[model samples]
Target chain A: MTGINTPSARHRRRTGRLDWIWFVPFFGFTLLFLVIPTIGLIIGSLTGGHPRVTLKYLAQLSQPQFLDAYRTSIALSAATALGAGLVGILLAWAAIGGGLPKALRPLLMTFSGVASNFAGIPLAFAFTASLGPVGMITVLLQQATGYNLYHHGFSLFNFWGLAITYLYFQIPLMVLLITPALETLGRWSEAAASLGASRWQYWTRVALPILRIPLAGALLVLFGNSFGAYATAYALTSGMINLIPILIGQEMTGNVLFSPGLGDALAVGMVVVMSVVFGLYLLMNRKGGRWAQ
Target chain B: MRPARGSSWLVVLLGAAYFILPLVATLQFSLQTGTRPLFSAYSSILTASGFWASLGLSLFMALAAVAIGLLLIIPAAYWAYLRAPKVRTWVEFLSILPFVVPPIVLVFGMVGLYGNGFGPLSSPMVLILAAYGVISMPYLFRSIDNGLRSVDLRTLTQAALSLGAGWPVILLRIVLPNLRTAILGGAFLVFALIMGEYAISSMLGFNTFGVYMLLTGQTRAHAAAALALISFALVWVFVGFMHAVNRGNITFGPGAR
Candidate 1:
């Protein structure tokens, strides 16, 4: 499997003209379920009570309410991505840099795998149980220090609370991403140290420069992950938060205030945002892949 | 040149506290059902009318998706490994394209392409099951490819061919047994995902476990907490099993290549 990519006739067999037939199931499945639906969504978003394509609903996206949703969604995603990305790098660095006990690395990694997969409604419940009104930590903090979090404007339904909830999975995802990237930087640090570079200097000149691309790439992924997430924010706030996914949900499920194509337009906008973010991620990864190797 | 133990321990401790405290708090919250029988929420949830139905549906969907995904992916991956490398790249990219189109958007597209409620396919379950197969492709392909990397498929196939063994024999008898770990690993990952999935299920008006959890969470806090713990337990069990079976070598979710 490793060396199969080489074009050597001796290494790879290009025989079996009918070999492509096996992939038809996959092609048909993707086309029917994934590709066709996305195309339908884009066309639906463009349709404006005419045979010709129009951007009337797309123009509706500039309305203050819709604009607010996009802003909140993007801000939440960016904040959580940067917040989790920083802390994840810290944890991954600690575990992989040989500063922790040997057993701790695998434990950390296994936990990372678990936590990253741990998202959606259950996560919202967990955070609410921890920090919601009358939650354990809320009650405990008020009892121990008499500091009412809610009185201090720390409601879990607000933007910051949602950010914290998002960080739970986002951080683990960042750890999973940056750990292997961290593993590749040990040699560079050692070389810098051998040149009598101080720890700070080694980090500043050698480690950070090489890591910048992968770090940015990882952050981009974290951003995209948070952006598309609907369940966590929806479950946590229940419409208190005006994020894009929840808004899209309302538009789709709306019976009374149903705008003609607003939901489809919003959905299309989300896909466009995600595409641009991932496109940059691919570019960063291509350049960063060279350094990591 | 030594790693900084003090800072490392500091970061690890802070991180551990942040991660573990929520679970602890969630457990405490689940148990704080005042003036009620001990764990009545859990008991009542078990006896709840829609609980089993929703959970059972999600479970069935997960199993079906895993089976269908394996059937489609194993052959495609094997064929690509033997014959075409370029096609493998295209298929793999398409697998992860679900990432860009969030579940809400995908369902929106489906509604637009098909009818709103019930349309061409007769049942929304069929479309959803197929979508699950497509969405599970990224992890499925990677994991099966990971297994394919470990064994010499070319040599095994050649040896089997020399013995007059057929393709079915080679795939089912030899390849299947050898790739059990990878297959189970990917299956568990998909199982964990589909069981907890909320977006696609809710958008389609399906009464999945995730949708059920949301409804319960809104009405009954105690029961919701109990259900939340159960959901977490389910995920932990499935993911832990995958990790243990793969000996912690398998990674869940896509991360670089």
Candidate 2:
């Protein structure tokens, strides 16, 4: 209570007793479910069917299958995040300052709300219906131009295909997170223009600097989002793609690979990658949020 | 102004195309894919055996998860806002921790820790429910925290305290009722999330709606398209409900990340 919103001494004294009781349920539940489970995975990743620690699973991660899963997943997440970050900033810029109809802002915000949450399986199937082998787009392209999509190495089960699927949510998320940052750009632009700077000069010299942090922060978030995603890609590929999540799934169900310890290591690797990106996001966002507010 | 306006219009339209094209395609596919009559795919899916069971299980779990999640998040977030800045910071970080841990990995950890069928979390339903509450921590916590941010809790609590209302009475009568919109917003968002969740349920061998949709998609493409639209509409309805309850104030849904 001491350093709350108003941090006054009397207010601090009145609430001197730390209200830690209210946090018990939240902490207790998370301790049992989230924290403990994570610790278990870390320990599980180290051991091989025994309580004592070993490095077998750790060594297994160096194999092509596991290495490829980690590499390909990172590549997938980065490509989509970078792609979404660029396009999303453009879209956010257009919405907030485009001088189009004023009505589009709320509409796009609402749409973004729906589209961002509209992920997981249905999204995968929706894309499949639109672009699968016999899908509408594929069929229409074939009929219209005598072009066969699957024949052209454009299968819905491949890496690029999954990137497009992920962009469906990633773009909206980027737009959503970066819009406030974009909204604040106008005040600075007006200031710059009033000071006789050209719009392009203003952007390169002023606006872009301010936006770089938030944009990077947003991209980091998008990377983390897609990096942690398992359901969408799994639903689309049905275990065809050798992503980390798919590998983890295989290990868990004992279908193709049955090493639970390896799965634990994969999970731990995933957590580390995501935590690094997320930690960077927090650091950037703390500085970036200064202007947006 | 004229050039900027034209380019902006183009950009918005292009983005709109990417957003709307799949929806139009899905609707067209759902309508024409099955037996002769329109919406045959939908009708067939409605009559499918596992459809009801999976959908019902997901819905039931959504309610259970929401009930349990709100119970855990609101008080902690509320008190953090009022009296515990350190705890608030810690909870906010924990809330977003779910975002860092993938659903599959979280369940992987859960099974590794408690797969012995000895603890309270052995049952698939219980495990999935707990996993959901954890996965949904980000959205639920964000939504309620947004609500808390909008309220003047200091003045409200102080006034309630001056009126001889105890902590329970204040929390129940004043705080809860005032936060009704926000809590409901968080609940509906959580509802939408759990409805479409796949990995945890499927990994645990639970027949949730998402698992059912994937199965249908493999066997029957047309009915699967129907399920896709139904799934899409459910998300829209629930997210739209969140906005409506908040009177058009969008709460970022799962996009809070």
Candidate 1 backbone overlaps, count: 0
Residue B34, model 2: lDDT of 38
Candidate with the greatest lDDT versus the true structure: 2
Clashing residue pairs found in predicted model 2: none
Residue B37 miss distance in model 2 (angstroms): 1.0
Query: Largest TM-score belongs to which candidate?
Result: 2
For model 1 the TM-score comes to 0.92
Off by over 4 Å in 1: A1-15, A255-258, B1-3, B116-122, B247-257
**Tens-place lDDT digits, model 1, residues A182-232:** 887888877887889998898789888988998998898899888988888
The DockQ score of candidate 1 comes to 0.52
Measured with DockQ on alpha carbons, how good is candidate 2? 0.56
The window of 10 residues in a row where model 1 chain A has the poorest summed lDDT is A6-15
Docking class of 2: medium
Error of 2 at A223 (Å): 0.4
* Candidate 2 lDDT, A1-293, residue by residue in tens: 54354424444556567567788899998988899999999888899567889998988889987899999999999999999998888898888887877889888877787788888889988999899898888899899999998998898889999999899999988888888878778888888888999867887899889889988888888888888788889888888899998888888888776576777888999999988998898899788767767
Per-residue lDDT tens digits for candidate 2, residues B65-153, read: 88888889988999889887878999998888887788888898988888876567777777888998897788788778888888887
lDDT of 1 by residue, B13-97 (tens): 9999999998998888777878988788898899998999999999998998888888888888888876688987877778778
